[model samples]
Target: MKTAPARPEAAPAPAPPVRRARARRLLMCRPTTFEVSYAINPWMDPAVPVDAALATAQWERLYRLYLALGHQVELIEALPGLPDMVYAANGATVVDGKVLGARFRNAERAAEGAAYLDWFRAHGFTEIHDPLHINEGEGDLLTCDSFILAGWGFRTAPEAHREVEAVFGRPVIPLELVDPRFYHLDTALAVLDGDEIMYHPEAFEPRSRALLRRLFPDALLADRADAEAFGLNAMSDGLNVVLPRAAEGLARQLAERGFNPIGVDLSELLKGGGNVKCCTLELRAPALGQ
Candidate 1:
């Protein structure tokens, strides 16, 4: 009888794609004057006492963490009267080295717009647009790879979307937010990597939800628990994600997706209706020779 053929060898499994962390240039403010004196959003309740010291300590941790992660941290001096100025992401939206200065919807934050724009002007940013429409900077406008995803029906006016598209020369996809609790787009959604995002669907209108699904088919979905914990209010450098420690469920989901999730305690800052992404603003300067 003929000898049996040798068995075929098994092929080794392919290695997982390595995720990289981009070195970001971020802007942040010290929460030295943090307090919830007024109720602008549902999260803010002046009746509840705010721990200013704890908020400062927590903010410092986040600031130091950015430095430790090889990201450039820039500070815009915090104005005494403007308690919410600590949410630096609302100052401006920087893309390709161009600045779109914010126009606050509330009179309480009106002066902050001028302060931030002055900083950019003083720092040598020329291509700046002082928007005519009411917009909240990165709080309502988020940049993706080829387009800018904007949220309206809350803080940012729908007209602001058109102005941003013209200023950036990029396509703007408008998403309508319905929930009062998730007023700002940054509060309800966080961009993970290039064109990758994680969001709380219930925070948006039905049409906006459908649009999000169509745009980002593989986006991470966060439950109401995680959303309420300010989980979606996160900052990511592609591979590493910094979010609230209270968002245990989102952390697990991020870890399962091969992302390094860094948990931080910003509960004190939360009293003022802000967190990681709120405190940190990304400065997306163009690459040399662009």
Candidate 2:
């Protein structure tokens, strides 16, 4: 019998370069007419109504606004007994084709993380992970094409910031959120069309403010009054912005810049402490991938 020729060794396969997932669509949970922990705790505000009818109406308006902006909205059923669950945006972060479930800093908001994980699994997203360190989802993350700016202090810790950097393999700038009122990074800042950022100066440290200005020299400084009215941190889809109905002046500014502003009345939601950007969680966006 002829001896068998030796098999040629197999070439090693090259490892695939990691790619960050881009958020093109999003998920938003409308606030129900329930008492949010913040609104009830410490001291209740009698003026803020938590009746089901009013909350439902406000959420419907918010839904219409998101739909008008060309977003594929996924509405979640109200979680009975969990008021903060309405702020679903604070639940998770999508990066590098993986969903990182949050570990909320606020005890009242902790249940939101588990809800996010459940949603991820149901949507067929198998690459889900969570940081061992305390962090509160996309609220702490502000991602651009090159870097992710994470806020630490109230919602996310310094240790969580470092862990996020390791997971993304990119630069993570740690920002100290000095103001407790504006708990998350998104509450104080947002990136709009053309790399322009809308931010509130009073919410950031002087050094952090300077760094932001340097990053986007052309960034328009939104007025304090407008910022307070939810004009500064509005969500944009390159063509339009979902803003507060009362922000007509800011809308005019955006219109001049070629953006169509669609206003939504989130009065009740705002009273509970947030607006459109705070209510909606962007799962992926185009700018995230360079």
For 22-86, candidate 1 gives per-residue lDDT tens digits of 99999998987779999888888999999888889889999999999999999999988999999
Residue lDDT tens for model 2, 153-230: 777889987788877676887777787766788777776653556677777888888887788676656676776676
Off by over 4 Å in 2: 1-23, 37-47, 285-290
Over the full model, what C-alpha lDDT does candidate 2 score relative to the true structure? 0.71
lDDT, candidates in the order shown: 0.92, 0.71
Enumerate clash totals for all models, in the order shown. 0, 5
For model 2 the TM-score comes to: 0.82
Provide TM-scores for the models.
Answer: 0.94, 0.82
